[model samples]
Target: MSTPTAGQLALADRIAHGGPAPVAAISHVAAAAYTDPARWAAEKTALFDRLPQVIAPSALLPRPNTAVPHDGFGKPLLITRDADGRAHVFMNVCRHRGTRLVEGMEAQYAPRLVCPYHAWSYALDGKLVGLPRADSFPGLDKTSYGLVELPSRETSGLIWFAFATDADFTAASAVGPDFDAFGLGGLHLFRRHTHDVAANWKLIMDAFLESYHVQRLHAGTIGPFFKDGVTAADKIGPHQRSAVGRVAELAALPPGDWPALRAAVTFAYQLFPATVIVVSPDYVNLMVLMPRGHDRVLVEDFMLIPEAPATEKARDHWQHSWDLLDTGVFGGEDFRAATLGQQGLESGAIEWLTLGTLESGVRHFHEEIESRLNTG
Candidate 1:
C-alpha cells in the first residue's frame, strides 16, 4: 500500500485530538436549484460540459486493445485503449453516414471497431483502417473519415474526458496525487453496477459531501462504524475531500504509522460537478454520476479491490464487502435518502433547504456551482 499523504496525516491528527470539523454559517439554497429546468440547462452547459469529467477508473480498460461504449453523458462515446496503451475517447459514431458504432456497456478486447451498419472498421486510435468495396465510392479519403474524438487525459489511474475541446483540466488533475497515495491506479476492478435514481445529480452528491446524515440515514448499516459529526474536510480547488472514521481507534495508533491511520479512516472525495470516490479500508468505490434530467441521474458505481481474488475464500470476503456497500449501504441508505429528499422538495412544501454547520461541505459545493454558472 502507498503511504498516506500529508493531508491524510493532518486529518488523522485533527481527529485524534478531537478537533472540531470545519464549520460554515447556516446557509440556504433555493429549492428550485434541484427542480428548475432552466437552472439544470445552465448547469449542464457550464459545469458538466465545460469541465473535465471522470470517465472511469484506469482499471476499467486494463490492457491494450480494450474498448468500452459509454453513454452516461447522453453522448454516445467509445473509450478505447490502443495497442500502445494510450486511452482515447471517441464520439462512438462511424464516419460513414454517422451511424452508431458500439452497442453495449461491457468492455471488449478488439483491435478494430467495425460499424454494424456498413462494416467500416476503425483502429483503436480512431483511425479509419479498412472498408469494404473501395470501388463503391469515388474520392473517399480514409484519412479524413475517422472517429470523432474528445479531449481526454489518463493520469493518476483515472481517465478524464472533456466535452468541450478547450476545457481546463487543472482542477481535475489536482486530485491525482491523492488518488495515487491510495493506490487506486493498480487496484483490481471487482464489480461494476449502474444505478438509475429519480433525483437531481446534486442531491446525490450532497449525500456524500457531509457526515451529518451518516449516523441517522445509515444507522441500520455502516453508520455505527463512524463517529457522529466527527469529520475533517478540505477543498482541492473545487473538489472536496472529507474523512470520517473510528477516531478513538485511530488516536490509539503509534505515531508515523501511516497504514494504520488509513485503515482507521474512510476518505470520501467529491470530484467537483459529479464524481465521488470513497476509499474504504480494503477497497475503493468510484462513482461517476451522469445527470439524465432535472429529476434523474445515472450512477456508474465500480468496486475496486487490492487484487484479483486468487482463491474461493478471498473471493467470498471481497464479495461480502461488495454486497455490504453496493446493496446495503449505498443503495439502501444514501441513494434512498436522495430520492426521498427530492420527493419532498418537489412537493413545494419548502422554498429553501437549510444547511447546518456540519454540512458546510454541501454549502461549499453549491457555492462553487453558483460561481461557475454565474460567471459563464
Candidate 2:
C-alpha cells in the first residue's frame, strides 16, 4: 500500500471531522457575464489569449510525424511531433494564402504538411520545403515562409499552448505535484466525447468545481456514492484540487489502514484557464472548456485508463463507465442544466448568480478569472 500524500491525508482528516473546506465568503457575479458579448470579448483578450491552456494530452500525439489540428480559444493550432520525436506547434495555416492546413487528412503521420490550396508543403518540423512552380515566384524565400510557430510546451503528459508567440509557459510547475502523482501520461486514451453546451464556458466550469449539486443534481448517478457538500479544497497557484469523501466505503475499511484512506476519496483538479482533470480510483476524465460564443461552449471529454483493457470483463467494466457518464451525470444532467441556465440568463430573468460557502470553488474560479482580466 502506498502512503498518502499530505493533501490526501489532510483531506481525510477533514472528512473524519465532518468539516467543510474553509471558505472566505459567498460571492456574486453579474448574470450578464453569461449573455454579454463585450464581456466575453474581454475574457478572450485578457484571459484565454494571455494564458497558457492545456490543448491536448501528450499521449494524443505519441509518435513521430503525428499531428493534430485544433481551433482552441478561437485560434487555429496545429500540434505535431517531428521524426526526431520533438513536439512542434504552429498556426495551422498556409503562409501563402492563409489557407487552413491539414483539414481532413487523418493517417496519423504526415511526411510533410501539404496545403490543399496551392500545394505549399512543409516539413514535419514546420519548415517550408516545397512549393509548386518555385521559379515562377523567384522572390519567395523558403526560409522565411515556414509555418508560423506558436509558444507551446509539453510536460506531465500534456501539451499546453498560449496565443502569444513569446508567451512564458511552465507546464509542469503550473500543474504542481498533483500532476506527476496522477501518472497522467501513463494513461491511455480509451474514449473521447465532444459536446457543445448552450451556456457560457464559465457555467460549464462551475458544474465540475463543486459537489454541492452532486446530491441534488446528480442524485441518480454519482451522488449516493459520496458525502453531500463535504469536500476538501486546496489551491495550486491559480488551479485547485478538491476531494469528496466516500462515506459508506471508507467506513467499511479496517482501522489502522492508513494507505487505504487515500483510496476513499475522489479528486477533481481544476487546471486553470479551462480544464478539469478528475481522478477516479480506476480512471481519469479530462474535461476541456472552450468558448464558442458568449452563450456557447465546446467541451471535449477524454476518458483514460492505465492501458487498453485486455480482458472481456475489463472492457465491459470500462464500457459501462462510459455509458453512465454519457447517459447520466454529464450529458444528461449537467449540460441540460447549463442550457436552461443560459436561457434564463439570456432572458433577463436574473440580476446575478449567487454562490455560497459550499460553492466556494465556483467563487474562487470566478475570482481567478477576474484577477487575470484585471492584469494589464
lDDT of each: 0.89, 0.79
Best by TM-score: 1
Residue 4 lDDT in model 2? 43
Question: Which prediction has the highest lDDT against the true structure?
Answer: 1
- For each candidate, C-alpha RMSD in Å? 1.5, 2.9
What are the runs in model 2 whose C-alpha is more than 4 Å off?
A: 1-5, 17-23, 105-107, 227-229, 247-262
Q: For model 1, name the residue pairs that clash.
A: none
Lowest summed-lDDT stretch of 10 residues in model 1? 15-24
lDDT of 1: 0.89
Give the per-residue lDDT digits (tens) of candidate 2, residues 128-186: 99999999998878999999988878787778878776676764366645656667767
Residue 99 error, candidate 2, Å = 2.1
Residue-by-residue lDDT tens digits, candidate 1, 1-376? 5766788888778877867545558899999999898899999999888899998999999999999999999989999999999999999999998999988889989999999999999999999999999899789989999899999999988999999999888987888889889888899999999889999999999988888887788888887777443688888899999787666787799988878877888899999889999998789999999999999999999999999999999999999988999888888788888899899999999999999888898999999999999899
Q: What TM-score does each of the candidates earn?
A: 0.96, 0.89
